[model samples]
Target: MAVVVALGAFLMTLFGGWVAQRVIDRRHLVLGLAGGLMLGVVGLDLLPEALSAAGDDLFGVPEALLLFVGGFLFAHAVERLLAVRRAAHGAADWGAEPGGPAKGKERVPQVGLTAAAAMVGHSLMDGIALGAAFQVGGGMGATVALAVITHDFADGFNTYTITSLYGNDRRKALGMLVADALAPLVGAASTLLFTLPEELLGGYLGFFGGVLLYLAAAEILPEAHHDHPALSTLLCTVAGVGFIWCVVGISGG
Candidate 1:
């Protein structure tokens, strides 16, 4: 199961990253589309399960709380680490000089690092969702994968673009590409370790859900709204939700 998941995630990451490169240059369309898809993932996949988890006694409430917290802390830590790493890298690159030689200096990618870290965390959470889905039923597990892949694809598309915009170097872009590619495999490999305390897992899940929600509302959606009219941007937003609605309806997810 782990190997299959690893391979699947890697392949998906590669595909998503590569396709992202093509659309990175398309700013408005990409942001709009990315925003919508993100909303869909949250509404169609994560929310339903999280809401259901609230009612299911076998999973336990404490466990659910832990999952949210764990995921949130993990994401927060990764973001902080990446931010620190970026600052250090920049300071080092500057080397106490005015307009130091930059071309050969190899300006490293802070955003790419964050993107890779974020996605790995994302994939690990998805792996849990996948495992949890199977606990319910085979059909539900497959359904979760379908929804997750949709999310992952959009995630790859946007991260690749955002990282590329920050990096401004094909080599840096490639690093983002490869790093994004590995995140899911890392997540898949960690599946064996899911036996940690239930509350712990619950905290992570809830926290991660919050991370996704915050990202969608605070970061991704606002970016989409900037300089664009609210209503026009909203149409795309609804379109994204509508697309997911259609997918869920068709797939019975």
Candidate 2:
């Protein structure tokens, strides 16, 4: 039953990806909205849940918060390392070439792929949470599933946008989108065999949240305004955040 309900998330994700593909021409708007959605998910959804689940402290701070900082630093370090390696290997001509495409922005395809992969992992966790909720009761399961399905649309949108933003091919972006869509189902099914530890899940969520926040604040938002400094893009970002807020409110989270 849990797995069956996850089909809703799968379909919603595909629809979201389709919407992103349709507006491929408005690159700035897409990044702006994606940045907002990522920020909302990290702040309003993931962090609160992580705090509740991983209620441990290290020194004077919560473990989840500590992991959150670690996650941010880790993402930054990885990006820098990748950039350095590419430069050393003579592959770092990341800026626009003369007389090339008009939107010749710097892109790091690997970073995009990594971020999308993290989204997929988070979706898988969502499915696991769905199945676990059902184990408690149908009402709980339904509530959790509703939250997962709604936010998953945003997840799909951000996944595709990030993948494309980093210079990955359309085919690769679509492939990642598909993987993300299917993750919930696989995660739900896996729960039939075993349940995950809550503390571990919380820690993972905290870390992933940091990575996502870094992408939004450092990468996506700046890129959105780099070329086309428009007010509509900023509005789209605010709308994106509001959308998630509405979803969380409706879900009683």
Candidate 3:
């Protein structure tokens, strides 16, 4: 059942990348909605479950929260390293010529590949979460699956966009997109081989919540608003949150 639910996410991922290739005008709206859905999942679903599962405190703070902070900082540090690497390579590729277009096109593919790869890792974790949730209970599993399915569209969109934006060839970007789509299925199946401790599962859920929050705020929303601050895009974000809320309500009941 968990694998079946994960398939929905896989299909949504493909659809998202396909839409990205075909549609240019409403890209911002799509991104806004994706960001909102991620935010909703973290706030409305993952956090509460993590807190419930992670009982007691660690160093006077919730263990799950500590893990959350760690996840956020870890992602930040990795992104910083990637940025520094990109800049150094950019300088090397283009030389120190002023007014040059920074013809660092060769370096761009590496940056895109790195970012997309990270997203694929994240998607795999999402699958793990789905399988682990089912271990806890069916209702919990369904809720997590729903969240994963919706957020996956954003994952695929970002994977393709990041790859292409960084000068990766269309073929390479599409290849990464396909890999991202398949990652969750692999993750879910892996869970059938081993079980995670409840506390550990909570920690992972909290950590992933932080990851989703960071991606939504740092990557998706900023890009959504960068060029297109249209009212419709903003509305789409709100609608995305509302949609998740409705889904959660229905699934929970």
Candidate 4:
């Protein structure tokens, strides 16, 4: 049953990616909406759930919160390391120019791919959660499925947008989108073999939430406004957040 429901998620994800592909010309709006959706998922959905599930506190800080901070720092560090490496390689290849390599352009594709990979992992977990919920009861399963299906559009959209925004080729973006689309099904099937611990799940969610937040705040949102700087782009972002909020509220109710 879980697997069957996951099929819906798959289709929705593909549809979302298709939408992103269609809007390539309006890159700013696509990015704005994606950024807003990421912010909403991290703040309104993932963090709250992580806090609820991982109830352990260490030195007056929730373990999930600690992991969240760690994930953010880790993402930042990885991007910087990749940037430095690219800079060095470019200098070696092109003969040490006065200004060095174009760090901004060179490092973007890596970051996009990394961020898209994280989204894939998140989708995998979503499927696992869907399957686990069904194990408990159909009611629980349906509710979880609803949440997963709803947000997965955003997932698909972001996966494609992020991959392409950073200068990755269309084929690579589509590949990531397909992977994202399939993740939930794979995750749901895995649940038949074993269940994940709630604490572990919480920790993972918290960490991923942080990674996503950093992408939205530090990468996606800035990129959205960098060229366009239009009111419509900002509104699209707000609409994205509102859309997620509504999804969460509905799921909770």
Return the TM-score for candidate 4, rounded to 2 decimals. 0.63
TM-score of each: 0.61, 0.62, 0.85, 0.63
* Model 4 agreement with the true structure over 1-253: per-residue lDDT tens digits: 9999999999989988998768645867877887777777678777787787788999999999999998888767765754522322242344446564564345567877887887798789778877876764564466557557766876787788678766789999999999999999999999889765888878766776776677677766776786689999999889978877887787672
Error of 3 at 240 (Å): 2.4
Pairwise TM-score winner, candidates 3 and 4: 3
Each candidate: RMSD to true structure? Answer: 6.5, 5.9, 4.2, 6.5
* lDDT (tens digit, per residue) of candidate 2 on 1-253: 8899999999988877988778544767866877777777678877787787788999989988988899898877865754522322222233444554543345568877887787788789778877776664564466557556765776687678778777889999999999999999998898788765888767766776686677678766876786778999999889878877876777676
Instruction: Tell me the tens digit of each residue's lDDT in model 1 across 1-253.
Output: 6436546656666677788666533444445655676567566755555545553444455444455556556656765766533432353345456667663255456655565556556666666665555444454455455545555665565556556544556776566666665665566556656554443333444554666655566555665565454576777777877876776677566
Clash count, predicted structure 3: 0
Q: Which has the greatest TM-score?
A: 3
What residue runs in model 4 are displaced by over 4 Å at the alpha carbon?
1-9, 12-22, 78-177
> lDDT score, residue 119, model 2?
75
Sort every candidate by lDDT, greatest first: 3, 4, 2, 1
Top candidate, metric lDDT:
3
